[model samples]
Target: MFSFAISKSERNALFHRRETMATRMFLNGGVYSMADSGRLDARVEGLTIDPVDGRVLAVGPQCGPVAASDVLQLPAGAVIVPGLHDRHTHWLFALFANAVVLGGVKTLAEAAARIEAQLAEQATGWVVATGWNTGLLPAGLLTQSWLDSIVKGRKAIIFDQSFHGALISSTLAKEIVSKFPREAIGSYHDGVIHEQYVMLAMAWMELDDWTLKAALLQRQIIMGRVGFTRITDMGVMGFPLLHALQDIYRRGLMILPCDFAVQPWMLREDPLLSATSASVLHFQLRWLKEFADGAFGNRLACMCGHHRYSDGQGGKLLLDERRYVDDVLLARERGIDQFAIHCIGCAACEAASTAFGTVMQRLNGESSGCTFSFEHFETVHPKLIEHVARLQRAHVRIEVCSQPGFLSDLTDYTDRLAAHVMARINPYGDFRKEGLAWRAGTDGAITGDDPWGGMALAVNRGGEQTITVPEIMGTFIDAPLAVNGPATFLILDRDPFAHLEQLGQVQVLETWIEGRMVFHRRN
Candidate 1:
């Protein structure tokens, strides 16, 4: 539950305190606090329609009109909309290794130059660097010999741009391999581990809890200042980590609003554990993410034509149908509401759809209430789009991780690598026409967190579909208020990115979540 303090009036007192907890406030004058009760009330402007109670309350001019309230007026020119719901973000991983950015380095020498600088600045015994794309590297693939020479004797690890693969020094690799079982050791090929193997290997390294905590808090605050009121933390691995973060925010050290989407493995370990609570109030914990295939950069996404590009060798499937079905059924049995399957390629999407349909039948009605979401529909086939539409009609949601940066980030000399040819068949407009609740997200860290970037990429046609920015944002604006907002909300046509301009020119504008002013754009 979320609580807040407000300026109120009592018995002629100008700024009296309302200590008693209250649920709803319809005050005719002054301010009030509901932090103790964990309820919040805020008035948002710049709306085309009134979105008060999950319904379109009003549209046209009436929607944007000021409501009758005794709370302090927010002053004019401050455009407000419903807080952003970033459905996909690698928040933890990004902050953990953000300063060690390694994008845009062309050659091994350039990469070494950057790593050498990072090592000098880093105070820790262990140094980790991320965000180097092997596909875009000037010298092609980064061999272990190349990484060894750069770090010399330091315990260093360089993660590929995909974050799924890494080039580790032999010293660090040897240190990590000791904790894992025998079978997992095969990931090391000349001390370079790719995909899940890299994550497992890095987990073995020592991490200072105190230092990590401070860094995350500082990063979260910075994001909040950037107008991010709500973020979905997909990086949280377990209940403890989620609990720790929640506690930090409850102490009023909030930088941004957040909703945690725990990984599937965490839910499997503790089925009854509810990561949701009063202090960590506004949360959606039902999403269980599973990877059907790895990333495209690594050529590990399960696809029918993966072999065509990689020496006539197809990609590997990360999650088999049996494991997929088991996880889906388990979430269903526990009354969990959703599962987001990271399916990128056509084959993976079809495989995931089948697993969901199978689980739907197995769970009967009690467990079928949970929705299934297919994340990153990058290389989807035309025929599969029809099946996906059917799933949406049956309450399934699709999250298209549209990042235009990928075009520049993963260019393969020609525009026909994996999804280049199939781009025309992505069918984004088709899904919209079919009336599916489609949402866009930047896999953040991997792609920058500019919502406009995702919008521009998705709209500026490829394959067979061409959508405009107005059309995409139009659908996006309506879906969240319809599906996630409180009783009576508002949808604004004003672009959030553009609204930042109003800050210095006019008032010291801000936005409040559950009544707490979490963001105040400075002049």
Candidate 2:
């Protein structure tokens, strides 16, 4: 196989540089050094990088260089910025992209036909499909009978676009119902599965270690090309995934640095405290993830009021409030300093805030440098925002990890929401004004993990709440580019601020991680 390798001169120059040496120069580019003052200092035209370890050596208009091969000169019109960070995503889902995708199918008939075709091609134990949008399908359209007609006694599981719900063939449904109880399965007749049952059914369709490792490696490469040097895998399962990641890193196949937030249930089951001590470079077990409610699109988000088109009743909560508080306290006691709670609605947000407030009060406002995050704070009601502000006033150190891509992905559904509810969606400017620390994420593979695409959605979704380019960039790149920081950044084909509306279309010309070029656009 043909391989792309750096020239001999380049390799020699890079290897010969001392740890304290400034031997590499990146010149003639609009360099965005994300300084601590929240200012966009883009006037710099050059940067000195320590070739030995890939850290920024100095930032200015000019830098000392030893050899031409050691210097990377930017092309005309190209701009360099800090590498993007996705605050929340399911790494497993991204790895499972090989599963039959049904993202754009408009109706139930289209979904069924696609599933039928997929199953016909595979002689399988169980067929798994994903990305069905129940919002587009008519009520009562996806039932056990409907799935049975397609699967024809074969076992199959089809997940909704939100991944919160699922439709299974009668064969699989009967098997699940028999193992558990009919009522425990949520709704056998409608073929709808939710909560823990979704995890249970998915566990049955297991992939071997090699398959998972390949999938993860492929996904990481794709993310690198899109300009992500680091990501936070929101809720990873157990040791298998971690073991796979360790194996990949050992084989020198790792691309991006990942921090895993183990699910609360998994932490409770094993508490894998030793896993944190395990020297898995590029991997950190950062947070304990808990779900407060379902997603907004499925009308299952724990809301203060009924969904506009639905049964005129608010959604249900996935985790009890008291239990959530207990979980937070327990996680802290176990030395897990951070928590990422999924809250997409007013009620869920309020519940999370209350739980966080209780934990803070008990700890006497000391978190030991730990942070609490409300993931997917999608529906930003003014009252909920106020509630959060009050918590911040008490030194709660709460952060909101939101998905700006929701504007682009769920446009139609959000448009049809109650006028009052729709008005509060993604209150980015409001969060900023209220002095709330916030960041943006893609929540892939539900949405495209394109950081620039997400930035465009945040920009074009016109409201006083819309975020500025600098502000959006701040969400991805938290700290300044300095000598000690990771040598991770991207070179874009065009300045993102210069082409705000076309941000999504702007190509990533080059991606660098730890001072090594991981991806370069082919001429």
Candidate 3:
């Protein structure tokens, strides 16, 4: 094989000068800098062709002709690849959002107990706690009495994990009555307030957007250290996006890569898109996030059949077909054509597919290459699978973001679900076998954001499938062009054997954006 080499001039020029060393220490009376203290770009001697971008870049070759600029040279044994992109994440909740989350508390008694303790702290005028799943909770109801007892005298409102519902105390209810018309608070009982009433109350309540962003940023930095380069902030909370952009500008820092899609209804009502600039846009797309149905775990997931527990019916559709169709059409007209729908059940998936097809037909194929993606394709039937495959054939990328962590929480529920239907849901292993691309999502509020776990869940077949390191990297590979994808070839540039020795689940050595280094192991 021909040896890859770099010119000597680049090496000397890239070496650090004395002053800017990250670490400099004297050993045996000689001072050696811990890092390339001066140069912005280190000179790498062993040039390897980058498979994805097709550039000759430096990588370390252990126990061989070593090059100083190669980033891998600093880490005793490691491999380098293009950055990892999450494609799906909800950073609005932050890390603490999932911790001590009172969302799943069963029974009004349990919820009341937790809230009563929280009320004692008297943190804020209106205490807000999230992470409640209605499907698993006892009685599966949010009543006024429950809210009042838990909140005591303080105004309180806790959002369901889905973000589609809210449980508010009587204090907040009184405030709601004062602000809106009597009709606005319709169907109001001491126990439950349904429909748009919750949202109306939240909108009226003053929320500190900046503080939420600050809280989210503090958590994002920790994610970066764990090797995450890009994350999708897939919710209506504009705080993370706003704060991330501001941070990048102020300090010339790049920690967490982000992509955000706003709610379509909000676009029509608030028009926040007009104020956003193109360069600052994450993922270079403005996807409209619409909900077709609720989540299965929460019993909010819409279904054609009856819900497992409820005799009346399954969950309701969060967005009516008319609303879904109108939003897609308006999103295209507004130049935000990318649509990301949250659909966990088959019924919901069909609605999303229908809406997307309708929008595409209406646009006469003038969508500027906009793609529609299904967020959590958790429960898909064979007919639906064929439908999605057909869409992909038509150049629409049908994507799936599954919460691997949910397997533990949902296994028993899934097994107890209709036997015929169980095969249709969370069948990622089958999807992979069919040559379909499966994108892993943290689904943050419900699952832990561990990419490795998601990767393992994607490839292995037995019990959700166990994934090898090579398989994990393949998820982001540009299929059709390369067998194992671009990153595979990139890995080949280094000492392949040694690199393999140091690989771990979800552990990344370096991160690059647009072919530039943004995060590297701090030797």
Across 1-523, the per-residue lDDT of candidate 2 in tens digits comes to 3222345454323322122344565546688777745567454677777656777777665556547655667888888888888888767774355567777676777877788788878776677788766556643666778878888998888786666667788888878756543322133335666655675565445565666776776677667778887888887755666566767665556646877776656555565553355326777777877765543233425221112233232333345656666777767666677877777777667666766666667677576477888988977677777777776787766778988887775554653466666667788888878777777888877777777778887878887988888788788873567666767778888888777877878788877777777776662
Q: Give lDDT per model, in order.
A: 0.50, 0.68, 0.50
Model 2 earns a TM-score of 0.86
Please say which candidate is ahead in TM-score: 1 or 3.
1
Lowest lDDT sum, 10 consecutive residues, model 1, at: 27-36
Total backbone clashes of candidate 3, pairs 3 or more residues apart or in separate chains: 12
Q: Clash number for every model? A: 19, 0, 12
What's the residue-level lDDT of 31 in candidate 2?
Answer: 82
TM-score of each: 0.72, 0.86, 0.70
Q: Predicted candidate 1: what Cα RMSD to the true structure?
A: 8.4
> Which residue segments of model 1 deviate by more than 4 Å?
1-78, 94-98, 138-141, 178-186, 201-205, 238-243, 250-252, 255-257, 267-279, 294-316, 329-335, 395-422, 425-427, 460-464, 475-509
Candidate 3 lDDT at 267 equals 62
Encode model 3's per-residue lDDT on 68-134: one tens digit a residue: 4332332433334444556667655552332236755767667767777767765665677676665
Error of 3 at 23 (Å): 19
User: For every candidate structure, what is the RMSD over all alpha carbons to the true structure, in angstroms?
Assistant: 8.4, 5.1, 10.7
Model 1: lDDT of residue 24: 27
Clashing pairs in 2: none
Q: Which window of 10 residues has the lowest lDDT sum in candidate 3?
A: 25-34
- Considering every candidate listed, which one attains the maximal lDDT? 2
